[model samples]
Target: MDTGASEVAHDFRPFFRVYKDGRVEKYKLIDHVRPVPAGLDPATGIETKDVVVSPETGVSARIFARTAGGGGGGPDRKLPLLVHYHGGGFCAGSPFDSTSNGFLSAMVTQANVVAISIDYRLAPENPLPIAYEDSFAALKWIAGHSDGSGPEPWLNQYADLGRVFIVGESAGANIGQYVAVRAGVAGIRVKGMLVVHPFFGGKETDEMYKFMCPTSSGLDDDPKLNPAVDPDLPKMACEKVLVCVAEKDWLRNRGVKYYEALCGSGWEGKAELVEAKEEAHCFHLFTKSERAEQLIKKMVDFITMD
Candidate 1:
């Protein structure tokens, strides 16, 4: 006589589940938070709108610009362009998610820059380089408008295209880094890149990568997941790179390794690492602690510095 024990012995986690036949199930962990529609966020005074980056691929982005001088015209000064990517292990996450929305709102106000948070395709359904490709496509779309002849009025009137920056958090950071690399090869000029708590691979993360990006090399040392292993580190497009890591996060070592590798890569660029002591991965997106505030300030300074 057998029981139903075998049926209950599955590995259905809260985020995602994988079956023996290669079927993947993803659960909506934060579905309750709706994306804030385009307009002025009363709390932060930042105006935002959504635009389609690529209708063919169904990729879009949310643009955030700081409202200036009593919400009339725009800021007195032209602002830098920051193209940001949000993280969810490349399996789940959206730029319109509550955390991402809130952070971008604050960042635009603090950094005084025009930001476009990319809504790239996720994986396990779209797979690995799909997200990377979508992000790079978004970069091209932004660059296409650099001559002030593009359709987007806000970017045309206010965005300083020559001072563009690429930024991301966690898995998004991973994507942003790859996009920056491609930018170098493609001759797209970017001012800098900032990766906050980038999601990198280890022995355990390698399994997740395999499931999400089955077509890739799927090794922990895959250059897509581990920049330290990439031979093109010296070819990064930007002149400066800022990598942030949390002291309590398990992935801190990988972030540090990336920074060290970039510094030693003879990359002809400046690389800096800032460690948030007593914090875990992406703490600034959740908690409003003093440390989180410091991280925001640091990011603002990094982007605005001469």
Candidate 2:
């Protein structure tokens, strides 16, 4: 009797959907931009190039280096290396997304560091530990170049491997933290980690994680997503950590809590927390507000400070 009504179904939602047949459908919530070719960015004077980190997995990255006579007139000596990861809840987004590309281009000029923005495999298709693995692979590739023996010339000529820093926003922050942990385990030294508006989770976000990574731990308190619950957080590769949050962001408390946990973790490292007054998540990336400029300045100071 009710067979007629059951025959019709609904699909297509904001982020993604799981159908009765186990098919996953993802919605395009934002526009994806093609990455520009390797060359000088006239507006920011940042030279960018894309390189493949792993040919088998097709994982690649966009590298940004400031051109001579660019912002701050370029550094007189080698610059610190900043490896960045973009955020999209592990289901969407890319290093070439306009917002990410623009912000990173400016960041390379502002921080005067040679930056590599990772393009990791997304979820539901590739899933959880895959992105983490890709990120770690990229990290190892960079580390291999520490002695100036790696393939990339920009890294060898301009990047100061000893002062390597890792930075990411939102879900990328989550990945960055894991990368730092793996680095520590591998004896790879990192100068610091900067997590901006990290996208952490509770029960609600945990459901999203499950949808994106069906094979994940499926628990909100999983150490990978909840660093506060991670016993080995003190073993993170970097001795310095900067956690940034915006006042109006829903995830602000998570960042604050992360800062507090790191401070009390007996990690023997310095952890600092910064709050952007009256702002939302990742405001600096999308808008040219005063706080955004402040963030850029703060990042520069952190990257260059002795």
Candidate 3:
């Protein structure tokens, strides 16, 4: 006789697990000591609200904006609307989590733009392209507010439709890039793309792309996972792009390579690269180091620059 314990097929602890029976269980990296509610963040004045993005798919997102209102009321002066996606390897992570809350609060306060942090469907249960689809759907919902008759009040009241930006970190960056590339077809015009410590370049064994999307041929060829290789790289529908990388992170080179590829692709958009010395992936969220503050400063400048 055999024990009832299910054998593990792929063990990616602190993130997820795949059992021989095809079951996937994800583990949170850290337990919430005290749950953060949706409202004003004390340190930063950014207010957040959870809203239903899609009724049919049960897709929701956390909206970040200043209660006092931000730029866009005139033709010459308009605040950029930022659509952010969080980094979690496409398996786990949340926009409302404490870490995410802290970072986004600071970001919103500094940049003074209405932000929508997407909480897309996770993988193993939802699988690859689901997160991508959910994100695009969120963008479409944001676009719905362009005519000032959308469902959400905050977006209709404050968000500037003419100025839109896409921001993502790590795996979320991959998702953001995927959406930005496809936004043109959907008639979604974006002003800029901010990709921070993006996820690209992985090996065959326990590969991230293969695990998330079994249909992928490999990490190198998949356009969704590696935007650097996508033939549509030149067609990215954005006026500007900011690619951030940490010198110490393993994926730093990939970010650099992406910037080079974008510049070489004849995309006709101004692309800038910033590498934080001695920093790790998504370090701006975890530490108060000088480098972290500098990164935030750079990000603010990028968003607010005319």
Highest-TM-score candidate: 3
The candidate 2 region of ten consecutive residues with least summed lDDT is 3-12
lDDT of each: 0.83, 0.81, 0.82
TM-score, prediction 2:
0.89
C-alpha-based local distance difference test score of model 2: 0.81
- Show how many residue pairs clash in every candidate, following the order shown: 0, 0, 0
Per residue, candidate 2 scores C-alpha lDDT tens digits across 181-228 of 889878999999999999876655466676566676657668777777
* Model 1: per-residue Cα lDDT over 1-306, one tens digit each: 444432332343556776555566777766555666788777777888888988899999888876556332243557888899998888777877788788887778778788889999987778878999999999998998788888788888778888899999988999999999889888999999999999877654466677667776666678887777888877889999999999999889989988887888878988889999999989998888999999999999999897
Local accuracy of candidate 3 as per-residue lDDT tens digits, 1-306: 433248888787768887776777777776652346798765676678999998898989998877743432333343568899988888878887887777777777778777888989988688788999999889988988887789998888778888899999988998998899888656688999899999875544346457877787655767775676787778888899999999999889889988888899878889999999988989887888889999999988988896
Q: Which parts of model 2 are misplaced by more than 4 Å? A: 1-13, 31-35, 67-76, 203-205
Candidate 2 collision pairs: none
Runs of candidate 3 with Cα error greater than 4 angstroms are 1-4, 31-35, 68-78, 202-206
Better of 2 and 3 by TM-score: 3
State candidate 1's TM-score.
Answer: 0.91
